[model samples]
Target: MPPSLKPHLNGWYRSLKATSRSGLRVERATNQPLAALRGALGVAIALFGALALSGPAMATSAALGAQMAGMATFQRSYRPRPWLALATALGLAVSTFVGYVASPWPALFLCVVALWSFGAGLAWVGGQTAGILASMTVAVMLVVVSLTESVSQAAQHAGVIAAGGVIQALLVLVWPVNRWGAHREALAEACASMADYARRLRHDPFAPFDPDPLMAAREAAVVTPGQARSRPAELTGVRPLVERMRPAMSALADPRVGAAEEGPERDRARELLAAAADILDMAAHTIRSGVSPKIPERAYAALALPDDGPILHGIARHTALRLIGLLAEVHDALETPPDDDSPRYLPRPGVRELLPLTVVAIRRNWTWRSAVLRHAVRVAVVVTLAEGIGMALPYGHGYWAAMTAMMVMRPDFSQTYSRGVARLAGTVVGVGVASAVMVAARPAPWVCGALAVVAVGGAYLTMRAGYMALSTLVTVYVVFLLSMDGLTLSRTAAERVGMTLLGGLLAFAAYAVWPTWQTVRLPHRLADQISAAGQYAAATLEAFASPGPVTRRAMRDALLDYRAARAALRAADDSAATEPVRHRGLRPSQLSDARAAVAAIGRTSMLIEAHAPTATAPSPGAAAFAGVVRDQLTIAAVAARTGTKVDLTPVRDAYQLWSDSADGTPDEILRDASILTEAVTGLEESLN
Candidate 1:
């Protein structure tokens, strides 16, 4: 090839890569833009109608519709009922009424108390909707208090807000979207994501692994299933399977496993993975179609290995064995259905059960060392201080200060900083646009009402896109909200900007005074993850040895516990990564080791979850070796908990025994056991 042609080709390739990466993000955003838009439009219409009927005196009602639009934070699986809307309305009414009845000092004290209590309640509830409701409710009350100093006015505002909620509820009922359908969609997307990963592995076994698609799917699946008795069992059952497949998929995609020279074995492994991807694709189809696919006979027979091979070749071969096991698990997962007798997703708790559960949640997370508790305290301090300052300043909007404080401050340093920046930038743009509109158009009350509805729609549509977009839309929303009362438009924009800046500064200052750095939390998070993984490993092994109802239940519980622990660790790690250079305590190498250790254990658990070759009879020596591997895993976990290094002689000894077993076991069990032993050793080394 000509030199000039080569340069142009390489440049073209780089451009293509960049374009494709950007395109992927844009595609994901636009994928369901329509549904999001439709939901937004519904809220907008409700708000518009409410404003048209009640005029400026009842403008707060439109805020309810805006809240509902944003509050679609409920789990994807459960259909939100009108009762939730009413519940929100009740909460908002209480916040407004309480704020109005109290003077500044009393209000500050009450606000502090309320923030703490609500934070505890949210911790107990542990759902998306609960957090959203808690935050938004407190924010709206602060806004109301700033807008109206008298109890009578506050009461009127609260009443109208409740009416808006009813209107939003009616809209939801009139054109209901099925939460179960959304669950199915999320699950199907997860399966497709996994399948895509598998396909990539098959084509370029050395390709860089990206877990984002699957992670996003898992996050989306966090919603509780609906209360309806008719909810599909598959909806709840697919979560665990998808999670179990993640590590196995990562194992196959490891570039080290694909570094060997191309040969028959490598070619065969690729074909098997291709076949696995097909099966996963079919499983996704079953999820979507609600029709079971016939489990085909073993697509490829377990490979026969020579007595020995090159180290890399051996590694590649072992990966193939693991992949085969995972494929079988997927196949069986599709063939079998969730238990027929399994109850519908736990019905939404009744009003009677809500407080008790909230109490339980608070108790569970009420420690002085708890991140949630600390965050609650920070919020109380920041908000109360902001409100006091706003009240003292004639030009300040007290509610704006309180609202920004509530919205921006977070438990983690990174999130708090990011939210503060986004909120400030968004406010600047939003206020500027709103100020321009008010000054230039000076529209009638009815036109402002319509614009308010549009703003609500805009807020909903861009909510997930980013904070900047959400902040802009919300600012526009606030503008229209204030216009209804015919407030002085001339200085409104300037005052809002000042208040927002004040609130943002307060949030940052509060955090600086009492920060909860992720690095400080890393030890506990990593320990929890290791402990959970250990429990899961033990339960999985026990279930393999004795496949009984009790063992299965224990395994399932442990799996869920492990998943939660891992999530916590990841969250902390991400926050730590975002810390400024001066604030970082842990080195990149140490963090990498921690991650690798976790992944190693995860792969071990997945291998064990494939049932440990129960059909094959193992020799006594092999059985003992398996026990040693289990013991070593426990030892590694204990060391992780204690934050120490430990000797791995037991694991090394077991590996030697397994390598010299008297009677040959099936390659599947042998390879599985071998992988488990390696994981135990890897974990020990990582911890060291």
Candidate 2:
């Protein structure tokens, strides 16, 4: 082995020692993750039982209304919050009441929900869906069969479900886990290490940043607690897989990670992120085909940790597994080729990242004025139309339609259409199943229990995938649970189906009429990514031209800004939020045009220091500096396509001084380093 390579390779690995965030109190003492997940499961099951007993529409309505009320607010960024007293009453009402109606002051929620969505509304929606849907089919005993046959049953069911959810929230609170800095540190360390791999690929002049590793690394970097908008208390009860990553969130200070990355290694590292960028192009195709075989192994390979081989005990393993499972499901779908009418399930990628950072992410990524007004207007319009329709009809089912409309509205466009369809289908299926079971068996206590189990199972299934089929199942199960007590299974199913159809049609129609404009021009947006890469390359040149103090700070700030910008670009690329809007006005293709630009930038940055010319008390001038930067970028571009660039510059740093000159190495290197140092420090700000 070459002497330099050994330390180069081991350098990153050695930095994995667990470290504390010097001077932090209440240092996020977290309980075991599996324990918390199990506890949440238990609570979700208990609520499912209560909701199934809701016999009539009113009972289900009021309960659902109350639960919806609590759903509107949260206390923390992550889920599984301490149980709030409000949650109990809300759950009980929603689960037990059938035909129970609560007039939602649309104006209030319209504004609030719009903001909430801009915050953590999307993640909260998924969590609540999981939590509330699991509580389905139990209202037969909890509200419907046991109580007066009135619409109030809806409120009762909602109350019990909310209660259970609240309990689950409390469990998350005191059960012990660092909700703040320590946890963030751990996540940061993991990301930095992953970034190192990307940096390596970015700099390898010989090898273009392998899209596989870059894609994998970027995908891994998806979630940061900063993205979630809701209170931590509200987010705690939903997707539990993310909670596992909390421990490593505090390990951000590990300097070894993303540091050793240079030259070819740096190029490789950037490619890892680039691959993630390519997913946007591949996503629709992948989803439609239901096969993601294109996902490269490098994406998974670099993420494997030495501690337990990456996919073992850590949260990354679980997330990776989730990806594999999703791929398998997509593969199965393609192979089987299900009909449009048949059950279809697709994974909701990136929710784990969004779960905790919901609000901050929204504030950072989206235009607040547009998000609030667009969402609020859409929701309000949909509600008013539904109410108008109800008032015109003989029945008072307008409330149901109104409620469904509210539930389906969203600021995130990716799943909005899917949600509407799912709601419509599930309501039909669930109501039909409930009505059928009621007619056949009179929905005795045992039958109710059986249905309750089905709801829990359905909820569990839904948790696994965000596909419409699972949504259908949840819809069926919840309606069945509510109608169990009413003893009118078939009719209830039909009504739910109708109500869901009404809501789905209204929400989407409203959205289509006047939706929030896409954030940026797709072509320009994609092009900007290349521009950013260019800037990143230029910054690298500055770093190369500088000495210790200047280089360190320049590299640090440049990478920080670059990382944030790159992340936004990638999210637009791979996340469902951006892909479906492929309209004639803006063709959102895989940004191949900018691909070369970014690759050149990432790779050049990695190689600039390597290519910098060095001499004892060397000259300091624009010509010498430009030669290094110019040569590095050109070589980085060439190496990306041709394989690697030759770094022929002689090393004149202290390490070289000690070995070759045997004199005051640090002093000697510093004495001659002024030119490079000043060049880098002065020029570093151009990219920003």
Candidate 3:
């Protein structure tokens, strides 16, 4: 083999292996019995209602609508469950109507499928829930519209489907199984993560922590004005304080910044961390249960500074003091009165307000350079081609092939390929199992309806248990639904399997031809992370120079931006790692070094943030140094993306100036400045 071909072959091998492994992996299912029961009840109600009013044919349509809407309720979104269900239902109804209208003309139907699939792909900009619901709408249209003959019949089917969605929405509103349940879980999980972090820091002061839980909590914070007014006191004013506690805890534990390793100060630090862990656990319980925290007496004692003066001195003492204060504030925040005037951080928009945002999101992804646009085009072409080919083939129910392609394809290579593999395996197993059940029992219509309901409920219960499980259960549900519509089990199973293979293979080929490889975007993502970290560092320094509420708020906002950027970069890197593509801009070593350097810069900023002074005294030359740092990093960010070396002369000069003018600066401020300078120097070396 040629040397050039080796990398490509290796990449393909790795990606294929990952795809197979990921397809087969089943995550542990989350125990949500009430939620599962609620979804099942919704399906049952829809099924029985349609059976009594119309026949099994209309009942199948209703069941599909209810099942899809119920799945929306399980998505990790802050939107109200009823609204999600309604949105999903509306999309399905519109798509079904369009599918039926276009079905008569093969060319026109292909065009309609292309347009709908494109829109579905573009919906990813709104987030995973929107994208999944939109794609499912396409699948629902393709499947449900096949039952109708005339325009009136199509409208009737669409109306019945919409009614099913309405029933699900109504059940969600009236049943109210766990109002604000997701929010509570997110906040509680974040607190518990902090507690765990604190405990870990006792042993490894620099323990790595994933900020995903806190990020989830922040997402959950977005609430409509009405929900904001009625929000639980425990949920408000607690998260911000919790965010501050992390840096403070880290600062106190670090030997370089706080207490000396293996000394009385270290021992004291461990005790305080243990106490903080207990306090955090209590706060998590309070948020989860909406009850007053039962503070441990030992935690209070551990937090109390000795009356004979503090055991730790300087920055370590200050950080410990800050951590203790934050802990107390969190406790108070948890115990806040229902009528407290604490400000809400994220106010969710109403439907009217969200329309413009949605439009803007779509417009942003309209450019040819956008991955979303590429994916949308890919989806349009692939689904249309699948439909065309399926129709050409000597087979019945050509829409199944189109539906398979719609469901399997994604913007990124990993997901599209993995889902294709999973869906194929899942469909085979699901169809086989369902076919066996049908052949053995030969159940009546009502019994088939019951089985469909059970399958849907099982799908809901195992949602977190991987895509393969979801596909399997959904396949079973579809099989049972079609069984009620008088389809021959053996023939249907064979056709279903064949069409799925056709669709899956078509999707895979389409992506191979026009792929959106994450590897190509790595440089841009890295640049973004670097820029965000620089801003965070600059903000932290500015806060040190001018300690005030405004500066502190800026620092907090910068911190959030930095975290988000880092998270995005990490996700991009992980996806790119499994993709069968060549590195485009940065070599592997350069990427690794750049990531390490950026991480170091973030850590330095975090250390400074830990000791953000309460006093309003300005540190000499600190502001100038911050400006230089920010400017240099901005240039470095550009350099990173453009594949050029960064020049750190300006930053080095500014650092020297700051160090020379440090006579009046606080000892801690000077120390942090030196660390920041070293981090910048490391970044320059890494980039070069």
Candidate 4:
């Protein structure tokens, strides 16, 4: 066997293993009983309302609308549920009407499918919720349009579907269940994460903490004007304080900067950390429950510090004092009265303002290098090909093949292949189970509708339990919904399974022909992260060199950008891990060391931020040193991406100049600069 062929075979083997593992794993079930019940209620109303008013045929359309809309509510988004339902319903109605109009001309309909699928793929720029709902529009078009014969019939079907979605949205408005639950949970989780981080730092001073919770909380904080006005007081000001506390705690515990590794100062730092963990836990509980926290006696005693002045001196003492003040601020913020009208820190863009942003986002992602664009092209090509092939086949439900292809394919190699396998397996099992039940029971049309409602409700409840479970239930729901039209159970099941297999295989083949391998993009992702981290570090140093509002704001903004870049790189790495391709620009060991080096840069920056100087005069040579660090890291980032070597001679010379000219600089600033210099050196070594 040729060596080239061996690598391809090995890649396929690894891909298969990853696909099996992810496709079959069941996630831990979250308790969302009220949310599940509310969604089920919407399905019930849509299903039974159409059955009573119209007939079994129209009931299918209404049920489809409610089920899709209901599924949107379960997405991990903070948007209002009513709006989500309305948007989904509107998309379904438009898609259904277009599909009906074009069905008479097969060639025209295929073109329409291609265009619609492309748009759906591009909708990912808006977010996961938008993308999934957009894709469902395509699926609804393929499935529901078959029931209509004429343009007027199509309008009626579309209206009823819109009404079903309206029913769900109306229920969300009138029969609200735990309003702002997602936001509260997100904020609470962020606080709880910090609490956990504080505890970890008690053991390991430099323990790494995942910033995902804080990122999620920030997402949750973006609310509409009305939501902002009504948001709980505790949730308003606590996040910023929580964000500041993390860096303060980290700096206070670092032996090189604050407390000695083994001394009375270290003991005091541990005590302070323990108290902080307790306070943060209390804060999380208060935010989540809207109740005042019960501070522990030990925590109170620890927070009191020493009555006869603090035991620690210099920066260590200052950091401890600052931490206590921030904690007090957090406590006061949580205790804010309900009538308090503090302005929101995050922007609250209404629908009218958001539309332009969405348009700009779509326009920006229209480039060839964008993953979304690539995915869109893949979808258009595969769906059109699948539709053409399905039409040529002996099966009656040709659209099922196209629908399967649309559902299984994603932008990334791992998800597309894994979901393809999972969808096929789930469809087979779902079809078989539903068929057995229908064959044995010989249920009436009403019974079929009832069973379909139950299946949809089960799907909603098990959404977090992995795609396989949800797919199985959704397939069962679809089968039962179709059965209401008196379709034969055995034939329907056989056709569904066969069409699903054809679609899955077509999708897999299409992706294999034109895949966007994440492994190849890892270097670019790492380069972006390194650049962002350098900017963040530079911003922090600038703030230290000249303490003012402008520099502070820049520091904050840079930190956020750094966090986002880091998250993106981590996602790329995870996706690359599941791919079968060989490493491209950076080898595994080089990538690992590079990540550690970047992390060190971020940690050092946080330490500087933790001890921001308040002197009126600028620190000598600090601004120049900041520029040097930024320039060096920028070069290193380019080297990472271009597979070139990074030189650190200029960086060493700049560090030496800064050190020699630090006669008037604060001792804390000098110490932090030294740490930053070492971090940059580490980065140079990792890159070269």
Candidate 5:
């Protein structure tokens, strides 16, 4: 109580507040380091166990686990699911059927090329798809077919792996437990990440973050899955499933959550926060029940879903601080945060410049060229490269190293970069662990199968969550598999290490050779996105004015396209080479602009798709509202510059009119329409 202690007490209190605040920023959304490590360990052990069970089990576990882990966040899209799965099965069957008629290599060579070409659509200008199921399918077919002196024997074995994946998928459908397991994992990760982020932000004051509710919501949605099938367009397996929940997921960024700017921005944030909270409830209900989560009439009604109150607030506060911290890290990282506005986590620049491809056109729509013959030559090229390496190196098995690289090499630098990083890390860790195990208790050859099984499990787990871990587990088990034939563990591990390093280096070189990063002109990309956004915004508003599935789909597609293009432009610019990193790209500033524009568009898109609440627009007059919206867009930009933040007040009359037009409740439409109008208005202001 003495005056002498007052100054010290105040300083201590101040320090405590600062620490807690900063802790909210730097740490990621979760603090599951121990769990992550455990997951990694489980992966290692599973993989080791798979190989020990014999090749059939190994193959089954690898493919099955891969499919399961990959499909965690998938939504139930019955549309293309059966078609894709059946088609994939038929393709494998035909390939296997053919392997019985001829030697595996010649046939596999054709298959691999077909696989490569078939997958080429995934590339974004100058990028080539890598490590597709086609490759694995061909590889498994060839390995099984070639294992025996006779051709029919190989087909039978290869069929086992395919059948395994099918059976596993069927089990997933019948009993959603497996699917939910992954959802649980994802949810835990999201929760932990949030907790961790909050903890970290309390320490670092300059972390970069923004209204990243979409991201957090994504994390939440990722954990709340009904597991859909994989699509070629998605880089991550569960993309479609995750995306279907976007409308609901958007609530994670509830305005109550992320709007950190003062004044109207705060109110806008609160509205969104309230909406997001409702959607989050819907999502939770849907995922937990394995059925759809119907939201209440009131958007923020989810706030009443038990005790998510503090957690939701924590998510918002931590994210705000986290952004500030990321800013500091980025400045320290690449010298600066590319440009002022955060350039998003992933970049995609929409380059519509379609170089007339004799190959692509044939592959996409033309049925004639998507065959075995077209594929053979491609496989031959890869084989020749591998063989050439084999001949060049004193080690007869050096070709395996080349094969490893060939397996990973892709057309895009970004993917290649990611693959290389994952492969490199996986190999090193696998080798290290394998070395340690071998040194501690040298196992028998038969026991090597057990090791292989454990390794495969590790690979399965890591393949989705941690690339490096996958590589490591795969590497160790692969070494064990090779050792089954009396090869020394030390030698095998050594070769694996050497092979992985060589593979990564050579694959990266191939990626660099004619690499297409697709962001050569970012301002153009921004212009394209902005232009499309304007049209899309108009279209979306029009759709809202008169809703239809076709318009909604078009809007979603355009929005997706814009975001992808923006990502490309941002990455290209940031990686701004004095000389292009490989050749074609844009300046980093251009990327920044593209990214910012994308975010603005994305925010607006969320509003467009949002479930509206009641009340009406300020004016039902379209022309007058358009002009007002335009002005708001401008003000929004200025607000961003001035740090006043954009206003998201609803268009009152428009909402009531919309309510009258649609069968939905008037109040809901009124509130949502108003919010969307305001967001669009703010966005338009920013864009101009």
Candidate 6:
């Protein structure tokens, strides 16, 4: 398992592992409470300002304050720029007004929804930051419209919503969280994780190979480069650096490389590995700090291997040299003028270009009919149904039902169902906690407001911890916001609980009506990943033979595509695993085999990528061998896609020929080629 997956896996593992035990233990109290504190402060300020500005319009102010506090959740995760923050807030205010304005008229409501849906689709297709802001805005609007009565009231709500956004914008300006900080941190963290992996591999060459850290680092690297729209050149090398490091790590960690009994040479190799880890740490630190460390001569000196030493020793020596090269690459990346010969820069698309692309996305999804469009339609219908159901109930808050549908209803079955369960449970517990506090001690409105602020912070802080914690905090925040508006406490808890349950049930029903089963998608996703892997492998091997500057961009893009497809396959399998046995698609073993093959391809591709750049004259047999491996990969990919039997004899024969011709091939190159051939051949066998 990749360490990246471990974070999620641990939660499930703990639950299953301790089913017969008494109960799970609390590890320790959290030390970093500043984020929570920041959240609370933002809300408190919004409330204070609302009260100061409009004394009589407390309800409007409460709504505005709540919106401001709610935005904290997004801030904590993304820390978007002030421009983006304001844009999202403005969208939120507009949606809230539209929801209210269209509430009394069904035709108007439909029109507004159609418009919102178009814009939402466009924004969703744009990127995560935009998608999140758009989704949250729509949710807020749905809730507002359902809750508010008249056009006048809706207008008031809109004004206050805008005011709240303005206040938050001011907060952003005053305490400007670095927008690109996460990008820097993610790349740094990836390097750090690689360092850790290297350290582990040094002590035990047979240590379980966990690519999760590297996967996460790659994900972060790709994302951060895109985020640097203003200066794409600065992050150009990040992708290549990660790509280069990945193969080196895999090559070094091969159990066969250093399989011999331990000795003084092994210890010396261990020292080199440890030193390589230090270089990785230095690279990570340099990326984050923008200050290059002086590379010591000892770092290179440590990698010296005696002639005709152990095979493992040679492997360690080669791996150490690669790491040293990577270290120098990192230094150049941080230099005043980068010294890299080839940099992987990404160009940001302008709005004009983006609009067309968005249209294309909508059209493609609409024609091919993907989960995105299905989910969009699902949200629209479910929210409407919840609204009508709420209006029918004697003590219903339509906003609650609509908001629940908006928040909980996902396109995928697993997430939709899981979110519904969590939302329902969290609401119940949160309402209960609020009721207990309010009934036991009837706190003043100001005190309730303060509690609301605190809850907002807690919610933001605990979001990643689990849905239950987040829900509890959010519920408290909402109840406190309502309390400030002089809402009756006697039925508040009951109404909240009932409405939440109703909303959850409705969202589930929406999906159940036209569910997008992961079972149906798993095979397709896996095939896509296989095809992408084939492209990447071909590009990498072709680079070795081309002799000119390889089209690194094509290989990089294919790698990204492969990564995305692989992630999707994993997600689909996870969803399917949680479903009833009857609904499962590929068996566990099949999925496992496919994943192993994909990973094996990645390793082989990396091997090719590592050695391709420095080729003078490709070995006489190397190009022919590469061609054979590439053809086998393509055939394997086709087999994976079409579910056909594979034949790899030709590839095997070619590898044998390459291995037999040992006249002029460098030992290191021969070793890498051997590794690549074995990986490719093994991958084909796995698929078969």
lDDT of each: 0.63, 0.40, 0.88, 0.87, 0.43, 0.64
Candidate with top lDDT is: 3
- Per-residue lDDT of candidate 1, residues 441-467 (tens digit): 998877776777677666755665666
CA shift of 137, model 4, Å = 0.6
**Tens-digit lDDT track of model 6 for 356-464:** 9888877877843477777677777766677667767887455577667666655566666666777777788788888888889888777877777777777756665
* Top-scoring candidate (TM-score): 4
Show where candidate 6 strays beyond 4 Å. Answer: 1-32, 55-79, 107-131, 146-153, 177-181, 203-243, 252-268, 282-319, 328-353, 367-369, 441-444, 581-585, 618-635, 653-677
Q: Which lDDT value does model 6 have at 606?
A: 67
- What C-alpha RMSD separates each model from the true structure? 8.8, 18.9, 1.9, 1.5, 16.2, 6.4
Q: Please provide, for model 5 over 1-688, each residue's C-alpha lDDT reduced to its tens digit, 9 standing for 90 to 100.
A: 9997887577435533442332222212321333233333433343344445554334433343333222221223222232333334444455544654554365444444345433433322232212253444443343333333554454544454445445434433443333233343443333233333333333332222232333333433331112222211111222232343333334334442233445543443344344443444444343334443354566534233324333334334443233333322322322221332222222221223234563464457344222223233333355445534543676634545544654554433444456566677667777788778777877766566567656654444444454454556667866665555566667666666776677567655554454444334334445554444445454445444444666567666665555554455455455332212222233344335434544554555554454321233422333244434444444443443333444435433543454556443334334444555554544434433
Task: Identify the superior model by lDDT, candidate 2 or candidate 4.
Answer: 4
Task: Give the TM-scores of the predictions, in the order they appear.
Answer: 0.77, 0.49, 0.96, 0.98, 0.52, 0.81
Q: Write the per-residue lDDT of candidate 4 for residues 555-612, one digit (tens) a residue.
A: 9999999999999999999988888887767899999999999999999999999988
Q: How high a TM-score does candidate 1 get?
A: 0.77
List ranges where model 2 is wrong by over 4 Å.
1-162, 170-373, 387-392, 412-414, 445-450, 516-520, 527-531, 549-554, 573-591, 609-688
Ranking by TM-score: 4, 3, 6, 1, 5, 2
Poorest stretch of ten by lDDT in candidate 6: 19-28
Backbone-clash count (model 2): 181
Number of clashes in model 5?
125
Location of the lowest summed lDDT over 10 successive residues in candidate 3: 336-345
Please give the range of 10 consecutive residues that has the lowest summed lDDT in model 5: 224-233
Worst 10 residues of 4 by lDDT: 336-345
Candidate 3 lDDT tens digits, 46-109? 8988998899888988898999999989988988889889989998999999999999998998
